[model samples]
Target: MKLLRISDLRAADIEAIWSLVGGGDASLRGTIAWSFEGNGIRTRTTFIQAFRDLGLAFTELPNLLKTDERACDLAGYLDPFYDAYVVREANHARLAEFAAASRRPVVNAMSSQGHPCEVLTDAFYLHTRVAPLERARVCLWGPTTNVLRSWHELAGVLGFPLRHACDRRFHETLDKVTFTEAAILPADVVITDGWPQGADDPRWSLTEEHLARMGSPMLLPTPPFSIGRELAFDPLRYRGFAGYAQKQLLLPVHKAILRHVLSR
Candidate 1:
């Protein structure tokens, strides 16, 4: 009956989960289905392959663009058949309601409030590549979107130093989180989500100049990045940059979720 939020997990819990993922192949019982509003091609493909590798039946519920009520109804209908429900939607409140009503464990694929799976994968990647979660100086450069919110949640749970550099308009929306307009220097990891629509501010964009100011840090850009907006050049050229597509992270994340579900 536990809601899977990053804030609810302890540092030991995260390490244990990642350890399980690293060990390879966790026990997953019954079927899994993904019901999403957005086109999660990468997510769906990665998860389907993961499930196939694990010998589990996986289904992608045909983009059921339902209203909040209909989505909850669908969740109720699928509760008996599926062991786990992975949902991505714009409505965070409705998703919470659906999770509460579901008999199975609910995974927040993505929501307006947070993107826990992405953050979890990012954390694991950082722990392995950059530094331990406790020691890593993380800097998030973008609006106070769901991705940033999840990072904030992770920072709260793991007690990591997470700095933010965004416009003042978006800064006020972040609760109890302080950010600066000045450049984010001396960072161990520099991450960014997509640029806000209609903002059109070059300062907010993660260009070559900003990357230079950040020194030699692990550059991790969230997927679906634009050339002119998110980055000035192709990230693939940079040795430190994690690739544009994060489909590979999905396997570890799914394994971690399965481990958590089995443990419960």
Candidate 2:
């Protein structure tokens, strides 16, 4: 199966997957052609037979419906476009429509709306670490930009309750969900992710003080800074586990979704 990921992944990062596949089944192509005023196309490599990026070379579509149909046709005509069309964290409504129209499995790798697949990874990882979803109380503290989609998807799929805490800027976005900044954290689980580059606030970070109150077996998407294996006795903190692992592990699931969409 072929894969198209526009999430700025480096060629070397997927080396392990390439090695196992006996090498050179995939190729990488970069492009910003879908969006105007975007960066130009770049090149990379992968395990697939080939990969290509259109870059910001054209803007012929004036209507979303028409653009989507064109994209769908492109996928249909292109030999490597069938397996998956991963719209990586894009906010393009037309692209989503095109993906749906292309009859290709669409992967919501990351989106301004939601990160459902990441939520799947989190659920699987938590289930493997903990006993049950009900047994865990997750505290999600960060900007809604990244977690918004994932949160909803997680709740829908696992029924696991999540308590949210966001800054004043995003309070309106949290209107649908019950939340409080003063809510006691370090519950069964705590997540502090998706930092804004220029933002000054750091209230959402999992500080050392926060770790003190954490229960046994903490899970942090990013690891803490420590020189050596001092083994800080702050429960079994699952650190350094990135969201990309989910993308790799869930390839089969994505493939099925792609096949079903394309079969139409």
Candidate 3:
């Protein structure tokens, strides 16, 4: 069982993952190889704590596994000893190749094309904290990046209303979902990915005013989000800014993911 993308997950798998988070999770314990980058401080810390709590050993691979041949060779070498593999890569195709080559369950920590784990964490948090996901109106304000793609896939699977607000220049890349400019939209949960370089529209920056106009929807910005880029005000002072505590849930969510995959 591998989860390389959000669309790869089924409804049953999604429920099972949530169940694991609720406790009484079985052993997902074993040696796990992590091929991740240096900038993944949040991910690394969460994974380390989750692994320790779940009785799994963590090993960081030195190589990025840039090419298929290298990824294949590494997978084969680790297949005998490792219980699972976690890969964080920018290239989706490369991560696919690696997952294809691995005999053990492979988990996508993240890729440029999608981020299943992070998005799942968000959905779970919303459901547990704000309201049922079905009742919430999600508004994603950013370019067509990994986070957006994952949210799109999950929203499709879950049958929720998701709106993408961005610069009109990038709308052509999106499909099927509701699209809008950087104007105020009726949103229960407002999210943002990274800022596009030189897309210096003040409207694109999610200001306190925008949140106020939207009736004080929760503001959950994706990690690596800059203060001045995607945000116009200090999010901490904002009423709906629950990101700091919300992000901490990544540990349990990821632990649930590991258990769900390995249990299969």
**Reference-based TM-score, model 1:** 0.87
Residue-level lDDT tens digits of model 2 in 127-198: 555546656676665556554445544553344566766666665443224465655555666555545455
lDDT of 3 by residue, 1-264 (tens): 989888898877887898778584455558988888557888878877888888888888855576446777977877998898888887888888878988999888888788899999989998878888878888888677788889888877777767888878767544437778756777888898776556666667788878888889988888777888788877878877875777888999999998888878
In lDDT terms, how accurate is model 2? Answer: 0.42
What's the lDDT for all of these models?
0.72, 0.42, 0.81
For candidate 1, the per-residue lDDT at 190 reads 81
- Please report the candidate that would top lDDT against the real structure: 3
Q: What's model 1's lDDT at 64?
A: 42
Give the better candidate number (2 or 3) by TM-score.
3
Q: Which pairs of residues collide in candidate 1?
A: none
Estimate the overall C-alpha local distance difference test score of candidate 3.
Answer: 0.81
Q: What TM-score does each of the candidates earn?
A: 0.87, 0.55, 0.92
lDDT of 3 at 200: 64
Best by TM-score: 3
lDDT ranking, high to low: 3, 1, 2
